[model samples]
Target: MHKASSDTLRVSVVVPVYNRPSELRELLAALVLQSVDSAEFEVLICDDGSTVDLRAVVDEFNTMNSLQIHYFRQHNQGPGIARNLGLHNAGGAIVAFTDSDCIPEPEWLSELIGPIETSSVGMTGGLVDFRTADHLSGRCVNYLMSSMLGAGGARDPRAALHMRYYPRAGNTAVRRELACAAGGFSGQRHGEDIEFSNRILQMRTKIEFVPTAVVVHNEKKNSRQVAMEAFQKGTARIRLAREQGVHELIHTLPALLVVGLTASALTGLFLPAFSKIAGIPTVLYAIVLALIGLHGGFLLKDVRALLLLPFYASLMHIGYGAGYLYAFLTDPSTSVSLERQTVAAKSPHDGMSEQ
Candidate 1:
């Protein structure tokens, strides 16, 4: 751990990392290129018990740069807990957060802190998008969970359909005092940022959305990884509901989709007489999914990715629905294994919509 003397820093960039040394290096390089002066902010890297010695990366970067950087390590806790460690040691009035895998734009820090500095808002969340849309699987997955499909809340304030707009830990800035007073992060393996934002909202603290403050996530997920991430996200939603009573009918849409598809298939095979009527929902769903895929493909400018979108979305929906149903069936208090699954899935704080 490298402890630097605290100065009158204006912003503290808190980044929680785990087993991503290369990504951390990239983030550090990007931070050095920020429009905000190096003297105006500091970067704190909180390690979440990775097998690799991440300190070496931080030290190597520090030797060549003038950025004020501090490193902290803890046991294998979730990103939420690791972020709490950063928040506790933050030396600035404003605490900005971004994942190690994200490469923030030059104006990211400036844009994020600008609103909070000028307005009375307690926190602000910026935009998170893909570093690249070249990969077919990754692009399809992004489309499936994006605002275009009404399944995500990371890009815009109106993106969220199932949950209230909340700042994600990956690209958010909060007043140091207000975040600490709200009790920091909840230490959950997933959805901890949303829970934290919920607490901030309970305090009636306004959270603004800054579209220009952007971070490009270096996403490199395979088909399996995409499906597994969706599954973990679904399970995490249930956990949030159990703990916070945060429920929305839209959250159950995937599960209902699973059930409805299953029924339709079974009915078509076993009871051929009503197969046409039973298949109506399936046909309609396919049309909607196709339209979404077409739109995604147009935006990505990739025909191959568009064709693969439907299959990718099916995997996403099915996996998420299954996980949701599984978690919903299991008791929350005794769902130790489910929580472990979340960590195993390496679920990061997802982007939420603006309030």
Candidate 2:
């Protein structure tokens, strides 16, 4: 709550990435250009298991940079593992995180670190923007892609509750001590951010979202690959819910809604040709499909995106719901022990009701 100096170099930027060489290059470039003082912080690019060699990019960046950027290559562990490694190596007072596909604004570090300047704070996240690319197809894709985001637009009315305005891994930061105290990230499957925050919350540390600290995210979508990612995200989200110990209903609720909506949409898609013509319900289904499609349509372009909206929605819902079911069946409540700390809960779905 106290205003702190924005130019402080107390923040450490941690970026966990996979085999996206191009995206990694883009993000590294962004890191070098940060407005925060180069001397105050260090950049850790933890490569999970890049298929291609990245030393070229790092070598090129170090040639003219004042910031000390270190590259760590680990076995093909998930992002969770990579981030944990970054946390272990980071020396900054504050820890900031972003993904390889995102471009943080010059003020990102300053803005994110500003709030955590208070001693009581533990974590903070910033606004994540799904900006449009210059191509016309890209514009359509952006709008369609982000349409499902009325969910993102819905801010927590409770100012005391941690903000989900931009609850994304690509644009979040946490204090190093708090993160270490909470158990450094590797406890989850997909939603490392959610799981990481859970440990912080358990420690009674304050986590906040600052909309002003923005990052322009490059939403990756090849026209042909949209449906597959949609399905994978759904599945990943369910696995994420289990990882964070968030109730399946709470974590997988969006997927459920999509399923319900998709069934209704499919019914409408099929009814248009029926003799009885269940016109009203079909129209209602159309409305639902259009609404949900608005989200995907903006994410994609042409007929494939539009034609596959219901399919993608179904894939996401079914995929996530199934994953949650599987995790629930196998390890309803699992613990991830690290060092002396153990991140586990018996029910994993209890608590937070009173929150």
What TM-score, computed on C-alpha atoms, does each candidate reach?
0.88, 0.71
Which stretches of candidate 2 lie above 4 Å from their native place?
A: 1-9, 133-166, 187-189, 222-245, 248-285, 292-355
Tell how far residue 272 is off in model 1, in angstroms: 1.3
Model 1, 1-355: lDDT tens digits are 3334445578989999999898898899999999998877889889989999899998897798778888888888888888877787777888999998888989999999998999899999988764264355655565565554636443456553434667888899998888877778876677778878877778888989888998877767877876787788789888878766666777888899899999999999999999999999899889977877787778777888667877777777788898898888886565332231111111111121101
Clashing pairs in 1: none
Candidate 1 Cα misplacement greater than 4 A, ranges: 1-7, 131-136, 150-155, 159-163, 332-355
TM-score of 2: 0.71
> What is the per-residue lDDT of model 2 for residues 244-337, given as tens digits with 9 covering 90 to 100?
5444334455555545555666766776664234355446545766665655555544454565555544444445555545545566566433
Residue 93 miss distance in model 1 (angstroms)? 0.9
Which candidate number maximizes TM-score?
Answer: 1
